[model samples]
Target chain A: MNMSLKNTLKMAIKSILSNKMRTFLTMLGIIIGVFSVIVMVSMGQGATASVTQSIEGMGSNLLNITLTDRTIRFSNDNLSELSMLEGVHMLSPNINWVAPVKYGLNNEAGTSVVGVNENYMVINGYTMMTGRLINPLDIENRNKVVLLGSEVSESLFGQFNPIGESISLSGIKYTVVGVLEENENTLFGDNNNMVLVPYTTGMRQFRTNSIASITIQGTDAASIDKTQSKIETYLMTLYGTDTYRIFNQEQLLSTLNEITGVLTLLLGGIAGISLLVGGIGIMNIMLVTVSERTREIGVRKAIGARRSNILFQFLIESSVISGIGGIIGIMLGILVNRIISTAFEIPISASMQVILIAFLFSLFIGVFFGMYPANKASKLKPVDALRYE
Target chain B: MILLDKVTKTYIMGEIELTVLKGISIDVREGDFFSIIGPSGSGKSTLMNILGCLDVPTSGEYYLDGQEISTYSENDLAKIRNEKIGFIFQKFNLLPKLDAFENVELPLIYRGIKSKRRKEETEIALDSVGLYDRMHHKPNELSGGQQQRVAIARALVGNPSVLLADEPTGNLDTKSGNEVLDILESLNRKGRTIIVITHDFEVADRSKTEITLRDGIIVNRKVK
Candidate 1:
């Protein structure tokens, strides 16, 4: 607030403004540094958020169990016993096949036909839009009953009622018992373009008794890990080897979060190199400034400027340059983030902590790199400085 | 008042020891208009630097206003330069970036003076140098003599104990040089102590006392 400091600051601004091109060139490094950091971290955050949303959509407290060994197979009796294990709330065996489906004169190829048990609708959080879902009797009697997903019904029957209609798959005609509601949380395009059939009927039709995968739900969130270990142990006993992989949603999510977190940090580190380079650029320009203004330093010294005064003037000048660069870089970074979000249609989360850190780090870079040149300016003797040509 | 007792200055350039000033002694009292005349490398500049507190004596004592400043630190010397000595250089030394008014206010800014007082003093100094109307012109925009006048105003704005001018009119034509000399004469008439260092006899003739130097020693001293 003192006049000396104020005047020094004014001098600094005037000098920096006088050399506009050089100042801007010096700031380019920091601008690029901050921009890349924000964009990369934001993209990482977007990826994490999308993966989390998709995982949560599958249902919380859900576990997927897959058998890697083709030789080992699960019988109905074995699956029922596995369902009775501790912490197990529900379990559904699934088998997937691609087939051409026809209803009326309309036909669709590569229509995903999923074979699931009666509990599949409940365990996978599928909602019934019309008619009724597959009941236990449908699974027990190996009935040729089917549920149509919203997209499948739309493709085959258009606006007409799909329930009580017959859809033929692989020359087998099955009555559509119900249609599933559209799942908005589906990540891989549309999950609605599918048909669900009773596991028994699908096994008979597809001539494959081997189940592809099983989805299980724990009693609650806290019991998922315990349920996962129990299922692993039960499978190990049945197959005499650990060939099955049990993926719990919570564990998988945390691992995903860890990977993305490291990725974000790595991105920030790479961007930090440019910031360091930017600091060096400032130092280089400041040294040139000090030398170029050598006579000015001498004149100031002769006019009674203390060593500290000269030091502070140059220090303030460099800090102002980097501070302004930091602000501009932040704005550019946010702009880049906006561009990416709009272009990709992915919502990016911007954390305030990251922005604050980037700004402060830039300022620190100014002070840190500005020290040498300012010190050199301050240490010049009045007589020698005045004599400097 | 300024006094030197057997002051000597030696500079070590690599292995060569060059003594620019060797056992020189002189005295100038308050209200005295003095000039130091010498040829190139005669240590006149060395004496000026010591008198202005820009450099210290190597093996002798220096007194400024009864204070022994020979042993003063760089910081203390800076304060003495700020508070006690005003320097007017041959090149004018006005910062190119600052206009006349800001350049004149620079010494007072270093003194931590309030803006109101600084403005008042700067105006008086510029008016004294007859550059009040041209206070907003930068150094490059002004003629050489006008720039020197601005430098003189900067030197006097802080009201230092003495004005030490090194070739104040060295770069100007005869008319502009005489104009600067007239200003120094009038300022001396107002009881401001002035010291002019030059090789020009015409410039030295205006001072009441003159010291002639040759080979780092004062060979002649004259009083009007």
Candidate 2:
């Protein structure tokens, strides 16, 4: 004789419903375990995504090179030659000088003043809030002109329009060109805290005729790698190997992803322990339930219940409990991700794949842990069970 | 309809191996109402267990419907109990969660009967015991007499060849006990072969045949 799975499930549900409090307590472990796992993974993915996004926004088709060899120097002729290289769209000498900056009464002893040319506006991700950018004429006439970053503008002008105004840098008055928009804070230093000046003025300020740092914008992603290798070859002849280092967005993105990937797994592993404990909880409760219902098992067996029927009855009960808990955990996890992501603006990655994996794992826990108790119940002797009292 | 040849039963408790039933033999024809009367510890319960197929004999041959059952496995015994023997317990062992109709319908569910046929047979069995209106009531909602009637319905729903009742009225009031005894006699009058295990003369007096057992052996036999 065969018992339908539907009837067995019905009976299991009836038993679970009879003891509402204990069943819910058993299910709590699975819910909390699944919820934490989903949230932790989303957080790790969100961090990785935000990093990649900021780097991509900064333009992936660019090369940043810093010269470490102090013996070699880039003359004006050498700068011209490098700019004329194939696939080089634009180039800006990225020279940083920390010096005293003052606007009438305001004075800061160590403020970062960066040097750039006309193409620097397009090469770096910068947008003007007011006034104009440095022009080629300012570099030719060696005129002192500076663009104020959002933070620099706030410190120098105090809400007053700084465009067309003059600020003293290194004891020299330079006319302010424009104020830049506020930029997002990222791992790669803040662009809002610096002041930009013409490279000619900056070279004069640093008292160095040769440029040390350069930011080159390539034509596109396909040609950037080719341009980098060619530049590296030429730079070796000048600065030598291990003397000059270059950075690319693709390399940085890969490294960031690798770190986040490991972090995500670590979080998942920790969460998995809780899920394992939940399964053990189910097994413990199920064993107790089997022993408690000994007489019931005897009655069913006396009435002709096969071992398979009894096995399914208990197995289905455990699955239903954990399955319902899993659904609640998934919804709660997504809700938590939504709340946290909104509270702190970040792109949290929550994919259906993770949800599916967690759900299936919970169901697996039900079956795996329920096996022992169910088998014990099914194998009970009808005579002994009936006489168990 | 039933046959047993020197059937024996023993239980081992630690180092002491005690024989509950030394040797027993019996034969009952089809449609015969049989009764096994004995005092407590006289092996009547053990004999009933063997007859109900809930257990096996220590040694000897048992035949039911011309099929040798002493060598049957546990699963085979379960099937034989399902298809051939119906047991009515003194405690009215109904699962507390289910209603009267569900309790009566359980055996058919295990028998893998379709829902329509199961419903039909369950209704008929409950109606035969005059508890059709109380089918929806749970065990705790009914009195002792009504609970026993429901148990009878459960025992009859499977349409087994013989009904094996162990102390059918052992835990009932005088009136409730008489009511259960009347139901058992009426079922037997309908040509349902029944065997009742009891120590009470009041229960044995109604049966067509009685076998008095003492210390696991038949001491007297009466055929009326």
Residue pairs with backbone atoms closer than 3 Å in model 2 (clashes): none
State the TM-score, rounded to 2 decimals, of chain A in model 2: 0.79
TM-score of each: 0.77, 0.81
* Model 1 misplaced stretches (Cα beyond 4 Å): A1-4, A59-124, A133-176, A182-248, A348-351
- For each candidate in turn, give its C-alpha RMSD to the true structure in angstroms: 5.5, 4.6
lDDT per residue for candidate 2 within A216-316, as digits (tens), equals 99989778889998888888887679888888777887898899889988998898789889889999999999999999999999989888888889999
lDDT of 1 by residue, A1-389 (tens): 12366788888899899999999999887787777777777777788888887877777688888888888778888788989999999999878889999987899989989899888889988899999989899989999999998999998998999888898998899999999998774533467988999988999899996785888988887878888888888888888666787777888778878988888888888888888999999999999999999999998888788898899899989988988899888898888888888888999856798889888999898889999999999998888888888
> Which numbered prediction scores highest in TM-score against the true structure?
2
Positional deviation of A258 in candidate 1, in angstroms? Answer: 2.5
Query: Native-vs-model 2 lDDT?
Result: 0.89
lDDT of each: 0.89, 0.89
The ten-residue window of minimal lDDT in model 2 chain B covers: B73-82
